[model samples]
Every structure is written in C-alpha cells, then in structure tokens.
Target: MSTSLAWESNHGKDPDVLIIGAGISGICTAINLLRHTPIRNFLLLEKGSQIGGTWNDNQYPGCCCDVWSHLYSLSFEPNPSWSREYPGQEEIHAYLKRVCQKWGLYSFIQFNSVVEDARWDGETLKWCSKVRVTGGKSEEFAKEGYVIKSDYLVSAVGQLNMPYYPDIPGLGEFKGTVMHSARWDWSKRIEGLNVGIIGNGATAAQIVPEVAKTAKTLTVFQRTPNWLVPRDDKKISGMRQALYRYLPPIRRRYRASLMDFRESWYDAAVVEDSDLNNTMRDLCAELMTKQLVDKPELVAKLTPNYPPGCKRIIISDDYYPALNRQNVELNTGTIEKTTETGIVVEGKEIKLDVLILATGFKTVQFMYPIKIYGENGRSLEDIWPSGARAYLGITVESLPNFSMLYGPNTNLGHNSIILMIEAQSRYITEMISQVHHARSNGHTLSITPSNCTVETFNEEIQERLQKSTFASDNCNSWYKNEDGVITNNWCGNVIEYQNRVSAINWKEYEITGSCAETLLKKDKSRLGRVVEESNSALIPIAGVVSMAALGVAAYLVRYGPRRIR
Candidate 1:
C-alpha cells in the first residue's frame, strides 16, 4: 500500500495578530515586530504550503536575484554565509525558510490558508477576515473557507502574485508545452528540442541564455527593447565570505551605503543633472549601440527611443551574447498569432516545438478580487479603482489601522527591492507596535493623511514620472497599468523615503477610543498638548468677573454689616 504523506490545514487557529501572505516582506514584518515590542498577538497566514513565497513559486532555470547578496538579507539578521554575490532562487528560498525556522515563525504561520475577504465592524472594532484552506477530500473548493477576527489587518499579498498571459489570438489552441517562467515545468527536459520564448523582459533575458545551451534551436520574441546593464554577477570569494560570517555588521553597513546612493540613480536622469545624467545617458546609448555594433539592424531594433531609467532596467551579462549565438534568433517583429507548429510574425509563420511565455505579472491589480472592507465597510478595490495612493506607501486614507508591506510606487527599478522591503517591513513593524500600544492603552488610532496631502504626493510622483523612462510614450512597459500610469515604481531616492518613514508624529493621526474619548470629553479648549491661544481674552474675562464679584460682595456686606457684629 502507498503511504499518505501530507500536512494538516491551518484554519480556525486564532492568534493575537493575523498576517496575510508569508512572503519575504511578511516574514520580515513579523520578525521586526517580535524583536522590538512585547506585544505578541501575531500569526502569519500563507496561501502556499511552505514559508517561501516567490522563491518557492518561481523555480525557472538559472533564476537568480538581480541584487547583490550582501544587500539582500535583513539588516538585523545578516547572513555571512552566502555562496554567491547574487544568490539563485533556491538559495534565496532556503535562506528565507532558514530564517523562518530560526525565528520559530512557522509556529505562528498557517500554511495553505488563502485569505478571501476582510471586513471591519465599528462596534466590534475588529476586522472579520475570511480564509480558505486548500487540500481535503471531504471539503469542496466552493465551501473550503473560514472566518476570523483581529484588531488590525495588513495586506502583504505582494504585487507579483498573479501571473498574466496576454490574450493572444490562438492561446487556447496551442499544442505545445507553454508555461510562464514563474511556473516553470522542470519535470520534463528542454534539451535537444526547439523552443520559442515570448517577451524579452528580465525573466526572458535570464532564461534565454541558460536554455540556449540545452535547446537545439531557440527563438526570442521581443515586443520592445530594454536598456540593459551588464551584471557583475559572479561567485562570492572566500576572504569576503569570511568577513561577512565573522563580521556581520559589514553587511548592514554596506546595504545602508548602497541605499543612499544607488537608489537615487533616477534623480540624475530626471533632473537633467548634466554632468552625471548626460554621462550615464551617453554611456548607455554607446553600449546599446555597441552591443550589436556590427549588426546595425539588430541594434536599431534593440535600441530604445525613450530616455534611460524610464522603464525597469535589466542587468544581463549574457543576454547580448546569447542573441549572438548560432542556434538563437531574435525576432523583433510582432507575433500576429500562433499556429500548431509555431508562431506567426509579419504574416509569416515561424516553426517551433515549445512555447514559453515570459510575459510578467498583473501587478497593477493590487489585492483585487479579494474583498477587503475597511472602517466604513468600504472595499480597498473601491477605494482605489484607478490605482492605489498612500501617504507613505503604508496607510490609505479610508483604510484605517491597515498598512501595506510594499505599497504603491515603492518598487526600485535600479536597486534591490530587498532594501526597500526591509525598510517597509520595519516601518510596518513600527505601525504594528503602534497598534499594539493602542490596544494596551484602550485607544484606537488611525494615521490618515489629508486627501489634499495624498493628492499632492501623487502629483509629485506623476511629475517625476514624466521624466522617467517608464513614462515614455515610445513603448509599453509592465511598470505601468492599463491606463499607463506608473504606479509601481519609486521615481526618487529610497533613503529619503526611509528617513521620512523612520519618524512617526502622533499629530499625523487621530487617536480615539475609550482613553481618548475620556480625555477629550473633559474640555474642548484644552485639546492641544500646549497652549498657543492669545492670553488677552483670558485676562480680561478674569478681571471683569473679579470686579463684578467684588462690587456685589461690597453691596451685600453694607446691607448685612450689622449681623456678624
């Protein structure tokens, strides 16, 4: 008889605090909260069975993080034991799992529990959350769900959860083994077969070079040319590795240093900082042209007409070389449709055996379809149907006591999101501590920026967007939504954002509850922490009352002066 091996469901287990999605950001958020504050009502809820989120899902060939390994790990919990300068997906996944296990986050984590909806009731002052657990013979897909309540709600369901495939004409009719890089089918081999890859984004750029060696013939369909920077991705050496292991502070110091400078790469491009921006532009243009300098036709096809730093720039050490390979052919033409044998381009059918769609994620759809009702029974999707806008990329105006791990415009096209993730996680941890503090003090606090403030921030983002490579009308990029609004990237320095988020002012929010109401009902005139009103009114009122009382006392004394005597 075959053995039945499986893990049980993580439903109906209530903790002090419930976190949705056990991604890197989620794990980091939990870790930071646990480290700082004494409040411990936290539970990490993951949709998948394991702790590693993206690292677990995207297992494509040669998949690796673009950021330097030294800067990728948490600042507080540094790993001096990285194998490479840039770690692969497996290593990254293993690192996260190890961190999760080390901190005993698994005990708090409920795997395979998918969150469906969250509604807030003012009377209860608790967010009623519904979660569904996958896998059970008795439970049907339609009815496998549960409900829970918590003081605070956070949506860490990252921007890259849902995979998107273009509605190309003959997608359902294709007979080949087609899959996204995020969900790479590795059970079967790719060696000695003709393969055609669609979209030349970061994933395709990485996969093309790796699969080229195995596949007999390879073809890449390029919708638009991306500005490429050669990645200095190589193995981490022994001496440096030893330093990291022996001296952990080295990693944090390095990350902080990089965050200050590299994240502002866009500022130069946008500001027209001539000496710096012009130099970078000229250099990128030169490289773009020189990449296939001899092949002018290919260069022309590959070179972007938009300014540098407009789109999410990719780092490829082998993409240019891969395109020059004998077995590979770069197709710059639009793919009209797909035939059973292959894809058609420019009214001509090109034959291929396998089709791989490296077409990225549906990132613009932030927590859509998942019903999240906030303070006023208002849905998050309804709040930002056009796109999400937040004060500090954490708190939404109407969504009270809720925070986002990596909210709108926080993505770094130049630096590692890990840095941004850590900053965001820490910021959220601080907010969690605030919630914990409020609960302890019998107060419900909400840090809501004015609509004017939110609008002003968005306007600034748009102004910067106009100068970004992402906003170029020359091409379509994933950094934008259907409306072409660049809501997914940071057009400024991350360090500045870090500093702004690091400090929290109580004045920014309206703190109200039993404690607040008790204090507030006492006096309307004494609301502020300090008195700033003019003293002339108070002096005149006291003087006039004193004189009136004196005159009345004198008259009564004269009339009754003989009684006491």
Candidate 2:
C-alpha cells in the first residue's frame, strides 16, 4: 500500500519514522530497512538538496576515503570495479547514489526538509516533530509550517558535517580568502596565489599536496606534528575487480583482515608498554625517513612528539612529497594570530592571498547548535551537559524508538565505518520488526536498554580506551575532545562491533507500550548471537580485531595512580 501524506500541517502530522540526515550512514540505514523490514512509510529528512552529505560538503582538492576501497563499502553490495585502492569522494558519492537507486530510496526522501526540534510525547509514546520545509515548494500541511508526528526517529546526521576553525583573532579583517577544508568554495580560485594553511591534520596534509600544485607559495603552519604513514595506494586492476565481483568472499576476507590489523595497531599504540610505544614510534620514524631524503630537520618537523595513536594517524601518498616542493614551506613556528596580510607566526610574517583552515571539526561539541528534545519535556541539549553519550551510539534511555546510526563512542579510528553501519542497520531493522510484531499482537512496545548494561558497556570501553593509543598523553587530536574525553571511536575491532550489534541481548531492554491496541502474537525479543567462536575462520582476522587488552595494560602503567577515564 502506497500512501502520501502532506506535511505535518495537513490534518495530523504523521510518518511511520522520521530519519534525520541523509548522509552515507543515514542512507545506508534507510536502504537496509527497505531490504529487511516491511517499513515503507519512513520519511528521510535531508536538510540539503542532494543525497550525498559529507561528499557534497567536502569538495576539497584531495578528498578521499582513508580506508581501503574494498573494505569501505557495504558487505551485501560489493563494488568490484573500484578504480583505486582508496576511492576518492566522487567515486564514493557515485557508489552511494547507485546504492540508493538500486534500493529505490529517492521517493522516500524529502529534500530541503529540516527537523527543527523533536520531542517525545509520553502520552502517545511517539515523536512530536516540529519540522520546517522550504517555502514555495509544496503546500503540504494545511498552512505549510511543519509540526509532524512519527512512531520512531533515526538520527543519522554524521559528526563531520560541522567544520572547525581556530579562534584566530582578526580573521574577518583579512581581505584575502579564508575557507575551511569542509566548506571549500571552488569559485574563489587559489591559482598562482600564496596560501597559508592552519593545522596539519589529515585534511591539511591531504590539501597541502593538491593546493601546492596550484598555489605560487604554500605555507603549512603546524602546532604539533602527526605520525604520517605511507599509503601504498594503487588503482584496483580489472582482474582484481573481476575476482571480487565473481568471488565476494575474497573481498570480504581481505576487508576483515585489514580492519583486524588496524585494530591490533591501535593496541600497540595505546598499550602501556614503553617497548611497544617505542617500537611504533621507531617504525613511524623509519617510514618518515624513507619518504624524505637529506632533511633530518624536516623529518623532525613532521615526526610527532606524542604517542602514535594520540592524534589520528596520518596516511598519505603525497603529503611528505608535497612539502619538498620548491614553493611549499613547512613552518614549525607558532602562529600568534591572523593579520590582514597573513598569519604572523613567531617573528616571521608570511603574506598570503588565501588562508585555508584545514583544522578538522567541532567534534567535542556533539549535536550542538541544533536543538533536540527528548522524553518528559527534557531537551537533548540539557541532557548532555558534559558531552554526548548514547547507549551503543544509538538510543538514549528516555528517548524510545529514537535511534542514532553513527552515534557517540561508536566511531572507529582504525577501520571502515561501513561495517559498523551495516551492523547498526541489522540491529535497528530487528527492533522495527519487533514493533510490527507488537502491533500485530496487542501491546505497545518501546525498546529500552538496561541501564546496568549500558553503563557497564561504556565503563568497559572507557577503561579499555584509557590504556589504548587513543588516550595516551600524546598530541591532542580530533580523536580527543576539549575535556580530553574520547567521545568518538570504538576501541574494539570492526569484527567485535559486528558481533555486538548482530548479537541482540533482548534481556537488556525493557519493551513497554503498544503501537496499536489489537490482538496479535506476543512481541518476543529476538535474541541473537555471534555465529563463530572467538577464532572464526570464515573471514580474514586482520579486518576486525580489538586493541582492548593492550590498551588496558598501557593504562595501568601510565595512570595506575588513577582510574581509566
């Protein structure tokens, strides 16, 4: 049955589910829902015109996925014809478009639609959504202003959409161009111009190589150096693509192995063993030396003083090489502030026509600026005074039927987020299915995870992360927030995350309330379990392995004096 309801203003505003953010994770969630459940009435609310969120937002010169191409995609829909080992933004965007088309998610999407605020209605146990759609588009609701309702809410809005800029004084006074990497404006050309880039993170490193090719003189200002690694990138051969296309398990195994290895390195970096840290540091230095010749000073400038995993590990095929370019200057001096002419670093004042702020995102401030209200007249803003915390990066205790796809502490710094996204979809789809089962049987259902379980879950992660490379007293990074709290990233392997999501512990949630008062089968919890033992042999071990144990050991050595964060 196909039914189209006008905007919330029409009669009573209602949708089966309201999905916020039509990004990769969000789109994936929607597509998976179509594949698994009988959910046809969900509204995909995208603030922008197009479907690609981050891909649309980040149009910087050298934009690409950090993870290898084979692993970065969905397990069900493997693309054999990946041009490069690591696909660029355009390819990833096109892949997403194809995925959407294959699953037919376009009709369900509402372009230019924004959710102003969503509140939980306790009486009905539904989301009372206050939304706003662009005017002059379609007169849906009787008047056009949005106030809708939905049985469930899915917050798939990604973390990286918000751009971060250093509080450089006198930034506006600069007559020259200033742009964040995420908000790159192509119309304002940087051709033959002198450009000053602030903060040498992943984006900065990537941008330097691309912009250097164009700019007359490019100066990269560094606060602290990140551990840079060689990305052995290459175009996927036709034969390799054919192999993955015909034999999917090969791709799957390779992806799993890669994820596992990366996760293991996390342990080595974060673990308390000075021996391990030293080994990692030595290995990183060796790689740096291999890239640059006869420039020990340059190597030192690029080498991180902090632990390997403290900040994000820098990976690039061009970052170090770009620095060696004649026009490019890597400045190790401190940037006092911005001047109208250029950035005044220490005593030297380098003039620039364009200033690019490749300084990462406002990750510490989770779900900021945007207003979100949960159950019992409680605002989501008010709930997270310190920082955002979600049960499995999805649900809040009071917020029933509300799910966040790529929520807090669920981020992985090591491997592909695609793996996590798939698992999340599976878990969510099961929950939605249960809701349907509940309606068929006579009971209202709201999936609420046990507080003990949730708290233990976070505590365990916190304990493990404290000892991991991510929490070491290294250079500050986007990985760590303002308060030095690691709010993002799963410290475990992608495989472990898959198991956690796939294995549903129904005993953990309190399912109460009914969608419709009717006679049907009792909505029993569909308990799940990990298919294979700890040492499963179907896939490669490198893809999804945890650094949890090593991280814990490292924490004990460093901060045995105190508790793990």
- Using lDDT as the measure, the top candidate is 2
- All models: lDDT? 0.69, 0.72
Q: Which pairs of residues collide in model 1? A: 16-41, 17-41, 310-469, 310-470, 311-469, 311-470
Sum up the clashes in candidate 1: 6
Per-residue lDDT of model 2, residues 135-216, tens digit only: 4354343234465677778888877878877888788888899998988898998989999899888888778989999899
What digit string (tens of lDDT, one per residue) describes model 1 on residues 344-425?
8999988877889898888887775578787678887777878877766777766666778777888776666766777777
Worst 10 residues of 1 by lDDT: 524-533
The window of 10 residues in a row where model 2 has the poorest summed lDDT is: 556-565
What TM-score does structure 1 among the candidates reach? 0.84
What are the TM-scores, per candidate, against the unseen true structure? 0.84, 0.87
Query: Which candidate wins on TM-score?
Result: 2
